[model samples]
Target: MTRSHRYRSLLLAVSIAVPAALGTAQAADTVKLGLVAELSGAGAPAGTNWRDGAKLAVAEVNAAGGILGKKVEMPEYDTQTDPQVSRALVQKAIDEGVIAIIGTVYSGSTMVNMLVAKQNSIPQFVGSEAPAIVEKGNPFVYRTSSGAQKGVPALTPYFKDTLKAKKVGVAWVNNEFGKGGRNVFIAEMKKAGIDVVVDAASEQAQTDYAADVAKIKSANPDAVFVYMNQEESARFLIEAKKQALPMPLVGEVTLTEAKVIELAGNAADGAIAHVGVTATATEVPGIAAFAKSFEDTFKRKPTHDAIKGYVGVWATKYVTDKVGKVDGEAFAKTMHGLCLKAADHPKILLDTCWDDRGEMSRPSFMVQVKGGSPVVIGTVPAN
Candidate 1:
C-alpha cells in the first residue's frame, strides 16, 4: 500500500475510535434511573404524584452535585395502570441501562413488574404497600413506605382501644394492595377480638358503592374499614355519604390522602386513617419543606404517595452515594439493614430503616380529615 493510503487508513481508525470512547465516557458520567409508574388510567393520581416527587428529588440532587459526582438522569415510563404493561415498561427501563428503578405505586403492578428489576440485578424502590412485594425475599426490591403487614396492624390498637368496637365491616378493592391490607386488617381485627360482620370486595376503578354501602349498613357494624385506592376511596366515601351509613369510617394509606379528600369533598370529612407517610405532617421541618416545594412545583397539595416517591429517590441517592458508585448489586447490599436519620440526611425527610427483605420501617401517622384537610391526630412509632 502507498504511504498516503496507509496514513488515510490510520486517520480513519483514530477518527472512529476517539468519538466512540468519548461517547462511552459521556454516558458513564451520568447516572440513569428508570421511573416506571401508572401515570395514566386508574392509578394516575398516585402515579403522577410519585413521578413528580421523584423528579423534584432528581432536580435537587443535581443542583447539590449528583450521586458520586455524576449527573442523574431519570427517564419515565408510563404503565397505564396495567400489570402487564408495567412489566413491559420495567423490562424496557432495564434494557435502557438504568442502574436503579423507582416505580409503580399500584401493588398489583409492582408484583408483576418487580421481577424484571430483580432479574436484572437492579435495585427497585416501590411505593407499593402490599406485604407480598417484600415478602418474596427479593433483596433488590425495597419499599418507600411500610407494607400492609406493618401499617394495618398499627390500626389494631385504634380499633380495640380507641374505637372500642366489637364489630367492624371491611370494604376493600380486590387487587393485590387491597387484598393484602384486608387480610392483615382482618387478622388484626380478630386478634383484637373484633368481628368482621361485613366483607365487601370491589374491583379496581369501581365507580359504584351503593350495594357495598347497603350491605355494610345492613350488617350494622360499629365502624367500617375502607381499603381501596385513592379514586375508589373517594367514590366509596361519596356513596357512604349518600347512603348515610351512620358508622365511623376508617382506612389506611389512601383514605385520607389529599387526592381522596379533594375527590370526596365533604364526604372525606370525619374519615380517619393510619398513613405510613403524610405531606401534612408540617411539624417535621424536612417534610414541611418538601411539601412546600412539591406544591410550588406542581401547583397542588402533595399526597403520601408523593412523599413516598420523594423519599424513595432521595434514599436511592443516599444509598448510592454510600456505595460510592453506580453498582446495582452493591446498592442493593447497602440497602438491607440500612437506616437514614433525618438529622443526617434531610432529603430523606424522616428517620427510616429497611430490613433484610427490603421492607421499610418508619414512624407513621394516624390522621383524621376535618375542615377539608387531613389533620395529624396521632403518631405511630415504628415496630
Candidate 2:
C-alpha cells in the first residue's frame, strides 16, 4: 500500500474502532468479537477483504438485532502480515476480554498464536490451508478451509489422469505453505505412479529465479509446479518468460492474488493456479449482499484473506449461537460437533458439513489462464 492509501486505511480503521468501542460500551447482552489479521502490508489486499467482510456481516447482523440476544460488536487488530506480530495481537485481543476472536489469516501467522488461543480456551477459526497448522490437533482451534493436504491431492489427478504428464518438476519456495504443497503433490503423484524429474528448492526471499528455471529446463519435465507466494511468483514468471521455458507452469494458491497479476503483468498469462473455489463469501446469498456493501464501503473486491478474516468472525457467531455463550469449552463442543456448511461463507473452502479425520470431501479445482483471466479447467480431486 502507498503512504496515502495506508493513511486512508488507518483513518478508516480509527473510525471503525471508535464505533466498535461505543457499540461495545452499549452492550448489555451483545457479543464482542475481535478480528485480528494483517490489515496492511502485501497481505493487506486479502486481509482487508476479510476485515471488511466480517464488518459487513456484523453490520447486517446488528441491524437485524445481534446474536445471543444483544447486538454484535467487532474490534479489529491489524497484524501487518507478520507471524510474530500476530502473536502479540492474539494476546491483546484476549486481554480485551472479547467473547470470541475471529482472525489470524495466514497459516504461518496462525501457527504463531495457536498456543495463546489454546491456553485461553478461546475459540479461533482460521483460513490457513497449511496441513501442519492443525496437525497439533488443538481442539479449540478450527479451520474453515481444507488443509493443504486435502486441497493439493486433487492436483495430482489433474496431472496424472487429466493432463497425463508422465514426468513433473517442482520449483518451490521453502516454507510451510510451499513445503506442504510439494509434499502433498508428491504423495499423490507417487500414488498414481508418476515420475518426478526435478525437485528443486527456491527461496521466497530471492530476487532472481533464472538458476531454478534453468535447472528445471535442463531436467526437461513435462510440467512444473511452482509453490510460491505472489512476490516470488512474479519474479519467477517474468524471468521464466524471458528465458522462454516451455513447460506448463502450475502454481499453488499463493499465486492467485491480484498482486501476481500486478507484478507478473502479461507473464502471468499462462501460469495455472489452484485455489479454493469458495474461500470468499461470493457464494453466500447473505455474503453476496455483504460483498456489495463491502465494495460500497471499502471500494475493492474482498480478497481471500479478507474472506478468511471474515470467516473467523462468522464462525464465532455460528459457534456462539450453538453454545449460547462465548466460553471456550462450549465453542469447542460446537466446532467439533456442529456441522456448519456455508457455500457462501467467506471460509467455505474450510467448511465441511460432513468431515472425518482422513481428508475433506469438498471439490478443489485447477484454473488456467484464458484470455488473460483465470478459468476453471476441471475439478482437481483426491484419487
Query: Which candidate should be chosen as best, given TM-score against the real structure?
Result: 1
Please, what are the lDDT tens digits per residue for candidate 1 over residues 1-383? 99999999999999999999998998889888899998999999999999999999999999989888889999999999999999999999999989899998999999999998999999999999998999898989999999999999999988888988999999999999999999999999888889999999999889989999999999999999999999999999999999998989999989999999999999999999999889899999999999999989999999998888988888988999899877888988899999999999998888999999999999999999999999999999997
* Clash pairs detected, candidate 2: 46-306, 49-306, 50-306, 144-350, 145-349, 145-350, 283-344, 284-344
Segments of candidate 2 deviating more than 4 angstroms: 1-29, 278-294, 342-351, 354-361, 380-383
lDDT assessment of candidate 1: 0.93
Worst 10 residues of 2 by lDDT: 351-360
- Given candidate 2, what's the lDDT at residue 69? 66
- Model 2, span 322-369: residue lDDT tens: 678657886676566456555544333344442432123444556666
User: Model 1, which residues run further than 4 Å from truth?
Assistant: 1-19
Q: What's the TM-score of each model vs. the native?
A: 0.96, 0.82
Candidate lDDT (C-alpha), each: 0.93, 0.71
What is the Å distance of residue 296 in model 2 from its true position? Answer: 3.8
